[model samples]
Target chain A: MLEVSNLSVNYRGIRALDNISLTLSPRELVGLIGPNGAGKSTLIKAILGLVSFQGKVQFRGKPLRRQRQRVAYVPQRSQIDWDYPVTAWNVVMMALTPSIGWLREPDHRVKQAVSAALDRVDMLPLRHRQIGQLSGGQQQRVFLARALAQQADLFLMDEPFTGIDQKTEAIMLEVFADLKRKGKTLLVCSHEWGQALSRYDRLLLINRQLLANDRPQVVMTMENLHRAYGQSLQTTMGGNAMGFSFC
Target chain B: MLSPLLSPLAYEFIRNALIAGILVGILCPVVGTYLIVQRMTLLGNVIAHAVLPGLAIAHFLTIDILWGAFVSGLLSSFATNWIRAQTRIKVDAAMALTLASFFALGVILITRLESRLDLDAFLFGDILSVTVKDVWQTALITGVILLLVKLFYKELLFYTFDPLGAQAMGLPIQVINVGLMAAITLTIILGMKTVGVILVTSLIVGPAITAYLLVKELHQMMALGGLIGALSSVIGLYLSYFLDLPSGPAIALTVFGFFLLGLLLRPVCNLNRENSVGKKLGKKYRSQKSEVSQELEPDA
Candidate 1:
C-alpha cells in the first residue's frame, strides 16, 4: 500500500501541484490521468524524491526513500537517451546490479532473471541488439522488462503507453494484470482515453489537485471531466463525445 | 623508414615521451567514452581549462603541479554543478562562466607571479621534454583509473545509461558521479604532460567518437577506442619525430584523422551496419506488424 499526504510542489514560485492526497491498496492498478501540464509527471517525481516537494509519501507504513528497492520506476521515454550503446539485455540486467556485487559480471542467476524478464516482454530474441535500433514500442518493452527484473512489489510508471504500438499496448495491459494478480500495486500515468481507460481498476483524475479518486466509471463523470479539463475539454476529448468511448 | 622511426627510440627523453603518449592514448579514450555517451565532452574541456589556475598556483607555491591541477579541476566542476543546482542557469552557461573565469584567473596568475615557468609547456605540453618521473606518474594514474573502471563497470554502465533509474534502485548515484568526476580529473591531470590543457579534450573525445561510430556496445567502443588511441599516439609521435611538428598537435590531428577515417570507411567495410540480430529483429517486427494490421482491417 502507498499513502501520499499534503503533497505540494512549486515551480518558479507557481503552484505546480496543490496540496493533494491519495492512497492505494495492494493488488490495485491506478491510472493517473490529467490534462497537459497538470503536474502528473511532477507528482510521480515528488513521490520518488527526484524533485522537491512539501509533503510526505509512505509505502507499506514506512518512508518511501527507505524502501527504495521495494519500488520500481520506469521514467518517461523522453527522459532516456536511446543512442547509448546498450543492449536490451544490458538494460534489463541493470536491475540486478546491486546484487551482482562490485567488479563482477552477471552470474548465472542474474543472467537467468534478465533472460526471463526479457522473455516476458517477448524481447529475448533481441537481447544482444543495440537498444537504439529497436522500435519505440520495443524500447518501451525493454524498460518494462527492466522493471519486471527488479521484482518489486510497487511499480510507478510515467507514460508507459505513450507513442507505443498496439501490440505493445496490449502487452503492457497484460503485464499490469499479471502484476496485479501477483499482488503488486501499480501507478501508471497515461494521457489516453478512448476505449483504453476502462482497463484500470481505479482512476485518479487530477489537475493540480485531486479531482477524483474512485473507480474509473464513477470518477470519469462529465462533471469531473469538465473540472479537470476546463475550457480545453472539447479540444482534449475530440468533438464533444463528452466521455471515454468505453464509458 | 626504419631508421627514421628507430632513431627517436635511442634518446631517453624521446623514449619517455613515447611511453607517456601511449598511456595517455589508452586512458583518454576509455574515459572519454563515458564523457561522449553522457554528452559531457564540453564538461571535460571545461575541467581541463579550469585546471590551469590550480597549475599556476601550485607552481607559485612550488608544489606538485598534478595536485593543483586535480584540485582546481574538481573545484571548477563542482562549482559548475553547484551553480546549475542552486540557480536557474543551465549547465552550459554555468560551464561557460566557470571555464572562462577559471582560465582567466590562471592566465593572470601565470603573468603576474613571474614564476619563470613556461606557460606554453603547460598549455601545449612539450611531450618530447618528458622525464622518467612523468612517465611513472602516468603509469600509476592509468593503472588506478583502469582498476576503478573495472571494479565499477556495471554501476557506471547503469548510471551513465539511466541516472534516474539507477537512483530509483537506491544506487549511490551521487557518490558514483563524484567518483567518476575524480577519475576524469585524474585522467586530465595525467594527460597534461602529453597534450596539455588546450588540446587535451581532443585526445579524450576523438578516439571515443571514432569507436562509437564503429561499435554497438559500450565495452566494445572502449576497447576499440583504446586501440585507436594507442595507435594514434605512436603514429603521431613518430610523425612529430620525422616531420619536425609539435607533438601535441600532431597527436590530436592524428586522433581526429582516425575518427574521420572510421567515418569514411564505415559503409565500405560495413563496419557500422546493424548486426545480424538487429537486422533480423527489424524484419520480423515489420512483418508481424503488417500482418497484425492487415488482420485488424480485413479490407476488400
Candidate 2:
C-alpha cells in the first residue's frame, strides 16, 4: 500500500534518518519498532509529506500527495494540542472536512460516518466531552475515531499503544484487525515491541535505517533487537494522567 | 436613589467610544489567540508599527488615515512575506527588520508631519476628535474582518491548530494565512486612530486571553472574547470620561483590567468543585507534560 525509497531526513547537520527503503502491500498490518531517535517518526513524517526529505514516497501506487485522501495519519497523542477547544465530535468532524466543505456544515452522511467511526472505537460515549479532558488512551482513540471518519484504505498510527491502558490497547488491536478484515492496511509505530509482535502480522525493525523486515519471530531476534533498541532497553516514563507504568 | 445621568452630547461620544473599543477588542483577541498560540506576537507588532509611515504619508496628503494605513500595511505585509520567502531569517527576525525599518521610516515621516500635522492626535489619540467619518471607517473594517473570519472560520481553525493537517487536506493554506494576515493588517490600521500603534496589541491579546481562561470550547471562547472586548470598551470609555485622559489608553488599560480579573478568577474557577471538568483538564495537562522526556540525555 505504501512505498518509500532512499528516504533521508537531516535536521540541520544531524542526520535523523539515513537512506531507507521499505514497502507495504495491501491489507498488510506492519509494525515499526525502534529505540528513541530511531527515525520511526521521521519516517512517518516523511511519508506524510510533513517533513523535508530527499526520498520519495508512493501510496496506493500513486504519489503521496495524490493519495493523501486515501491515507489517514494518527500522530502520537502527545503531538496534539489537547487544549484546543474542540470536542471529540469536533475532532472527528475535522477528519471528514477534506471530503466535505471547509465552512459548510456536515451533511447527514458525514455525521453518520463520524458516528460509525466513533462507534468502532467505542468512543461514542464521550463524544461531547472536551477533548482536553480525555486521557492519553482516550485521546489516541479520538484520533482513531478521526481516521475511521476518514474511511481511508491505509492507516498510519504513531505510538498508538504508548500510555494506553491494556484494555484500550486490545480494543485498538481489535479495531485494526477489523480494519484489516475489511481490506484496509495499517502501519503502526510502537515502542513496545513485545505487544506489537502479537498484534501486527509483519514487523520492521528500524533505527536510522531498515534493520529488519519479516515475520516477527524471524525479524525480532535478540540480535535484531540489539541492533535496533540496543541490549539495555531505554525506558522513559511519560507523566500522563493515566499513570502508565513502564516496569 | 440613583439617576441615569448621561447628556445626549456626552452620551453620543461615550457610545461611540464604547462601540469602537468593543469592536477593536473582539477583533484583537480573536486574531491574537492564533498569534499567541503560533508565537506570532512580533508579526502583529511589526505590522502595527510598520503602518505608521503609511499613516504619516496619509497625513502628508491630508487624505483619510485608513487609506494611508491600508496602503502601507499592505506594503509591509508583502515585505514580511518577501523576507520570509527569500532568507533563512526566522519570522521574528524578519518582523524585527521590516517593522524596525518601516517604523523608522514612519518616525521620519512623523517627524516631517510634525511641521504640518497634529501630534497628540496621532500619538496619544484624540478620542474627542473622532468624527463620524472615523466611525464609518472603523465600522466598515470591522464588518470586513468579522465577515472574513466567519467565512474562513473552519480553514483558520485548521491552520491555527494544525498547519500540517490543513496542508494535507489540499486547502490553499498559504493563501488562507496571507488572507488572515491581511485582515490583521487592516484591523491594526483601523484601530490606530483609537488605540494608537503602541497599545493596539493589548486589545487583541487581552480579550482572547481572558476568554481563553473562561471557556474550553472554541465557539464559546470567541463569543466571550467579543463580550470581554465590548465590556472593556465600555468600561474604558467611562473611565476616560471621568479622568479626562486619552480614549485609546483608557480602553487599552480597561482591557488589561479585564485580564487581571481573569488571572484572579482562574484559580477560583478551577477550585470550584462543580467545575470538575476544569480541574480534570488542569490535572491532565500537568500529567502529560511530565511524560515529555523519558529517555533523557544522561549528561544533560
Which one wins on TM-score?
Answer: 1
* TM-scores of all predicted structures: 0.94, 0.82
Against the native complex, each candidate's DockQ, computed on alpha carbons, is 0.52, 0.20
Give lDDT per model, in order: 0.88, 0.75
- Which digits, one per residue and each the tens of the lDDT, describe model 1 over residues A68-186? 88888999999999999898889999988987877788889898999999989887767776788678888899999999998999999999998888888888889999999999999
> Taking the tens digit of each residue's C-alpha lDDT, what string does model 2 give over B151-247?
7776777777767766765667878887878787887775666777777777767788788886666766778888888788677776777777767
Q: What tens digits encode model 2's per-residue C-alpha lDDT throughout A219-244?
A: 75657766776655444322331222
Report how far off residue B147 is in candidate 1 (Å).
Answer: 0.6
TM-score between candidate 1 and the true structure:
0.94
TM per candidate, chain B: 0.90, 0.82
